[model samples]
Target: MKCEDFLFLNNQVCVIVGAANPRSIGYATAELFAHYGAQIAILDVAVTDTTQAALRTAMSAKVGREVDLLCIPCNIVDPVACDRAMQMVVEHFGQIDSLINCAGIVRSEGMLDIPSQDLALMLDVNLKGTFHTCQSALAFFTKQQKGTIVNLASVAAQRGGGLVGGAHYAASKGGVVSLTKSIAREFGPQGIRANVICPSMTETGMLDGNVTEEQFNQVVAGIPLRRAGKPLDIANACLFLASDLAAYITGHTLDVNGGGHIH
Candidate 1:
């Protein structure tokens, strides 16, 4: 089977953290990679029968005949669990070719009104979690002499979006942008590429708690596209970064905000 030139990394294995549902960017990313002949491994904190994760993994594999996928349960806050998640991916796929950090948490309340626990959770999932996975991936990439990492940032990190209780979320995602750039600098010499994707108000379960129907519509109205983004919008990007097409891309945040960030 011939692979698309844009999919030069075909058959490469990618570990995606946080694929929870049809609405998850992680799931969309998994589907795209699988379609391009890349193997996939998923990790998530979703509360569901193990069958769900397995089903998603299988579905991702089914997207492309003969593609492979594996799913492992994990919570990024736990260091051992984080390492084990990577190990599972490597053990199943033989090597990890790429990593997409999609597991994140957001809490909505005014800054002062936000609970400290909520803030901690956001940091743990967004900032510390990225670090946990990146550190694990780094050792492997450094030893292999090449690798790719795509981190999910948020437009809030840049413009402060100023959402209710969004300060903590913004801080966490902001760290992602900075951490991504720094990681790129440290790993570039080793033939590793690291990048960030900042998406704005995408339709997903992640925002279910914060966005009401009216608020959602209001935000969409502000977008020049006059539409909210779908999970696929951000997932498609993981494909490009994982492929050789992005060999020259690193230390940058690609904003997929439907022109919301044009300002």
Candidate 2:
């Protein structure tokens, strides 16, 4: 089939979390979804009028039209906030067809150096936050009998903490993977699909100050692809999983690594 024949998300309303930063995976996913004609609702803890305006302008330029975008301030660590955010999207868009969770934080501190507070914060935002958002979306999906979820985990969760994250981050992401699988199993009978994406050493602001140029090059040298993963690489995977293209797939963990951690 031709590429244009694969317009899978036309008119679908998709919710993307943690998309305030233009360089983030969340933003890339939102942009790609809009390119495929999906209406977008971006929820971020750092969202502001300025950021929202910039995002709207940038997206409009790229899409060659006035993009349908909604920006809302949300802290996914709070369940109430997540629920309210979902409600707001439904109110604005009439319904939500998919949710892509790219909201998370990573720390490079080792297990021995990780403080209790740091661990708690990591788990709260990465694992518990994912739980909250998924639960909130499931409320509507259960009633509608269909929905799709694409969650962002990390290679840290698989290889036990890699170049940019610590033990706490890995543990939190592991919980995310497990939680998504459980959701897929429990909600599959209801026609709700849930999946996880584990990206390795992506080119994002997350690497700034976390890994030096030397460290990054050293890791990339070992990968067969001879390069790091890109936000668009993961975004493409997300689009496929979120769209009807993968309707029969659920509870699967897709690795968007540049052949970095093949297993």
Candidate 3:
């Protein structure tokens, strides 16, 4: 196979969940995939006509071509919503090739002091929401006998919450890790691939709004790479795992933490 062939998306339909803002990792992935010839269907609870238009404009600029973009207002926490949103994507695009689960929530409350409501919200959005989308997509994937799933986890899930998220957030992401592996194992025989990307302190809205400059500097100092990750950094990893380059890889957790795993 040619080097370029590994990265080519070739008009595949990629559904990105949790692309609420243009600065998010989901949007970055959508842009990169679009550049490689994928039609983008973005799902977010906050999606609006304005945000959709902006995303389409930005993606077209990046790819230097008009993009087929679908923006759906979807709350992944609802199974019916997930199913309906995916159905809409299929109806619009004809087929679903990949599903990227980036929909999640985070908070800075430790296990001992975490509020009950906060814990529930995290589980609902991070863990249960992932479950809903994966389950909904499974119907199409299994029927077609080919699909890819890339779920976003966090380093907090690996380290037990030392960064921005607290125990609840960590637990929810940890559940994502396990859930992704389960899908990989169960569906590998059916030509479905599932993997997780654990990003460490990415420079996204999720962290910017929650951390001060001092705290951010301290965290970066500890990282061997001496900088926080960018949404593009995580997006690149998604591109690889979603592409044929990773066709043989499944049930794997790719860490995009810039050597924070070493520290």
Candidate 4:
């Protein structure tokens, strides 16, 4: 495919989960998908999510919109909530061709200090949330015999996690990577593809609550690029994976960490 022709996601539906804010990877992915002509269904966990949904709508509108958009308030940790969110996407868009799992949370503490509840929170939001979503979406995909799923893993998933995150975070993300591969293996024959993106130290609000400048510099230095990854960097890769150009690809993990870890 030509570089220009690579913009292949046209008139598709991509349900982007975890659009917590404007700079979030979820929002970036939604924008990229919209730019390539995919309609968006943004699912978020908070009531305050409407603002972000509109912001993304406005951005896409500026680029010229030819389809309807829907924003759903949902918490994927609950199976009922996940069902409602997916049902809304189908009702609004007619069918769900893609699902991007970007909804996740984190709590930082040393291994010794990590409490059981925080550990469970990480697993609940990261791993369990993903499973709930994929479980619901898989049936629809299987029925259609065609669908795509892109999951958000992390650099922590590769290096056993960092100071800003912990064992639970890594374990959850590691489960995501493994689960993505399993989905691909089982469903590729059913015409469904699943993949994961692993990025590090993004400027998302997930870090807004606590990341210090000194800490940021140290994280950047560890990366060969000497810079933090951006949501757009991750979004663009997801945009491609959700397109026809990546039709033959599945069960693969893409790293958007700016050369931080070669694996």
Q: Among these predicted structures, which one has the highest TM-score?
A: 2
For candidate 2, lDDT tens digit of each residue in 1-263? 88766668988999999999999999999999999989999999999999999999999999888998999999999999999999999999999999999999989998899999999999999999999999999999999999999999999999989989999999999999999999999999999999999999999888999999999999999999999988899999999999989999999999988888999
Which stretches of model 2 miss by more than 4 angstroms? 1-5
**C-alpha RMSD in Å of predicted model 1 compared with the true structure:** 2.1
Whole-model alpha-carbon lDDT for candidate 4 = 0.85
Give lDDT for model 1.
Answer: 0.83
Per-residue lDDT, model 3, residue 51, is 86
Better-scoring candidate (TM-score), 3 or 4: 3
TM-score of each: 0.93, 0.98, 0.97, 0.93
Count of clashing residue pairs in every prediction? 2, 0, 0, 0
Clash number for model 1? 2
Identify the superior model by lDDT, candidate 2 or candidate 3: 2
Report lDDT (CA) for all predictions: 0.83, 0.95, 0.91, 0.85
Weakest lDDT window of 10 consecutive positions for candidate 2? 1-10
TM-score of 2: 0.98
Better of 1 and 3 by TM-score: 3
In candidate 1, residue 124 scores what lDDT? 88
For residue 115, model 2's alpha carbon misses the true position, in angstroms, by 0.6
Residue pairs with colliding backbones in model 1 are 109-164, 109-165
Top-scoring candidate (lDDT): 2
